[model samples]
Target: MGQGPSVIDQATFKEMGLLSWAIIDLAINWGGWAVSAALQTDKFYDMLGTGSFLTLALGSMAAAKVSHARKYLVSAMVALWAVRLGAFLVARVWKVGHDSRFDEAKKQPFKFWIFWTMQAAWVFITLSPLLLLNTASAGGPARIVWSDGVGVALYAIGLIIEATADAQKFAFKMDPANKGRFIDTGLWSYSRFPNYFGEMTLWWGIFITCTSGLSGAQFVSVASPLFVMALLFFVSGIPLQDAQAKRRWGDIPEYQEYRKRTNLLVPVPKSLFCGASCGPKSQ
Candidate 1:
């Protein structure tokens, strides 16, 4: 949980550039890869990401010269997020025994290495705001502003949505009668992928929280949220999940109707007024 002070000062960290964060990511992920490849498993991949975020957050704060309430608050948030999500995902993977997503990749050493590398990139880009803020030089006594409150509110909303959605799905899956049926109740009725919606919201929330500490070009860390959104929308998150759903239930009218009416990833209230006319069709 604790790391010794960075050997390189903030200035030297700059000289070395993003590589400082890059090295941290590669070191942690590649080390994780070594173990995963040896075992021929990807079960621990998400946990590794959780560890990367915690390290960037708490470790950077420990190595920082500018200590403030913001740093403490941000670091704590990151740690809390890591522990909650990491425990959940790790438990799920262990329950499932293996991640189907890695069925082919785990067999190829070079491909498995690429998966870990991409995971490293996910941590790096996603946690950039925290890294920048934690490593910044002291900016003098600054009052925590209204933005802090907004950030925390957004984060709480996101955390609740994501956690609740996952819990609901898990509960649904545990019921034997529900076998072969898709979840169209609870939060799933509001959004096909409420959990992914929660994931995007929380990352954006963290970015907004870090914005108070940022200025000028440093604001480019906006990629933290944008990358999350893009990754979910254009890349792995939505596409893979959607494809899997179609493969399983594509021919069923009920499943097709569910997709036709449910907002793909955004949670919206379903009502006869909004659903059939505007939002997802109501149950």
Candidate 2:
């Protein structure tokens, strides 16, 4: 079937303005916390955090005067990613019974609320590009472009890499023989945080696809991937994990060696001949 032309008009724009979307998105985030706080469990946070993105994306699509196939495709991608991540995180937290990250925060109402607000901000920044594209009164059905293909390829690669790394790590943790040992095999051999690399790549790909539909003020949506990268690198993902790993295994010669040989965030093939003592000293 042929793709339809864009149908966004002045009336549609007025009805689904950026501010309205932001308010709705933030409301969903804050609302999720009510259930979490009432139950006194943070296990639901992941599901709600991810579900918010899908909710907002679908909401925007529904608000559009004429939804194009591109809109549907982008929305589907966001939903797919969100569902996978949400399910994985929810399963993880459920299995663990509690998230240590919230142990202290949950005890203080204000601190807990701040964390929920941060989740709201995270959802807003990470999905900014998709949000803009979905709500914009832009051109006709998205034509397949080189960037689209490249973006899709990057996204697929990222998803596979992330899933693989998570599976490998989970399996390693489950093995009694691997107890107290760091995972330095499979994708982990290439980077200390291969999964994070994948996560960042996924957002970058999504941002690229957003560029296909965005214009003018919407260009500011580039912040989507940029924010994801920043959060993963300096703020939440890498820094925390790195610190935890170091605290757990800093004295182990092997882990120190592994740290020296492995890239911090980018994947690269490990040298086959590196000795236990060959790499640089730990920082």
Candidate 3:
């Protein structure tokens, strides 16, 4: 019903995001430690904090060698990406003050507990790769490999693309004229969620780099990418955004038309037809 700059300020958005993360972290960190201690071992290593553990794990496996540089590189790159995404989300949450989804659920005690607790679980599980890499590993070759070069290059490209896409979206939203409109410009034009695509690719590159040095358990670390994809697609990324879009533009004939033509997650060419399969028809 409204089309204008959000009344919500940036500071409030940041606070909401940070508070959500903080609440989730509190539940995971303390709950995880308690559970692990009771179990007498870190049985649920996957449930530890974010992928900071992956950093430590990779470092341990690499040991003190030339290849150790590769682990450090991977760790540094991932840390940067995580911090950047976290900060961005925090800013967005602050801008919105409180997420409507959270607010709605807050009225129901069971739903509130479950939602926040599950988010904490998701955060921990999703961050396994980084956490493992951060933990003390045996260390690796004291020289970098050709694989490291490729990994670094891929990661750099992914980060650049993701960062650019995010910036473009932010700038588009900041422009008052574009209020309540979808962004289909720059990298966004190429892919509906270029940022997410890049982020998913970045983790794969990191995983490849981390696994390049080893044989057994290292290969199993594919879980990191898998977890990220699941969370992004099903939990944090598209579904939530889509729901918001539907709420905002459900009554707009133009938006309904756009939704039919534009790709939901992956970027694709606009369709010429406006059939049921294409999506809800424009009024």
Candidate 4:
């Protein structure tokens, strides 16, 4: 906004262009992983994963010749979400000393490197929409479309839901009385994985915001949200958590009952009034 040639208009991007930009982005992502892998600590993965996306989005905008309000707004949203998520996860790992998910992976170099590569992929794929929007030449000055308003609203709701769910779960875990018990209160009461739901929703909202500006091959960026949903639903998020819960409480009648009534990712209205039936069944 202040001065200098826009990143998109710069001679380097003009000559080498998006392909070069993409290679640089890949380097940043892999570089972070390389550092983390050398240090042998997964602590930075969460922070770096989110931070890289923010960097890519903002960096692309900074390179562009034209400054668009929509681009700026999307950048701000990404920054806010990434910061909050990174800080939250970092604090969590700090408290726990280490993430057990890396236990076996870290012990094996090849597997661990694969994990880092996957993180890089996750960053690149999930952020495709914003990255494409920031670099695309189709749109002018970023007008406020109906999709933008709706997308922003969705993002806000998802952020609140995710934050609330995490806070509630954290609080529950802190209490001695709730020891060994799974969280079925607050947002968790409605969905087995409310946090994942919020995450998916927010990404979907982000994708929607980029829709109006997208044209031609740019539409392929819609894979951003779809990839997120798949990752959560089948790959990493839900399956892991669900298995953990099963190991911990599967034999208990209450947990089985809770699993039966509660939706997997979407919150159900019946969750509010279903009470005992919807809640954990008694031991």
Taking all chains together, the TM-score of candidate 2 against the true structure is: 0.88
TM-score of each: 0.89, 0.88, 0.65, 0.87
lDDT of 3 by residue, 31-128 (tens): 65455445433323232444333333333333332335555777677667766765665565565454455554545545555654665655545544
Local accuracy by lDDT, each model:
0.83, 0.80, 0.60, 0.79
Q: What RMSD does model 2 have?
A: 5.5
**Lowest-sum lDDT 10-residue window in model 2:** 1-10
Worst 10 residues of 4 by lDDT: 8-17
Model 3 is weakest, by summed lDDT over 10 consecutive residues, at: 10-19
For model 2, state the Cα shift of residue 255 in Å. Answer: 0.6
- Which runs in model 1 stand beyond 4 Å of their true positions? 1-18, 139-141, 270-276, 279-283
Instruction: List ranges where model 2 is wrong by over 4 Å.
Output: 1-14, 139-141, 270-283
Candidate 3 residues lying further than 4 Å off, grouped into runs, are 1-67, 107-110, 134-137, 250-253, 256-261, 264-283
Higher-TM-score candidate of 2 and 3: 2
Best by lDDT: 1
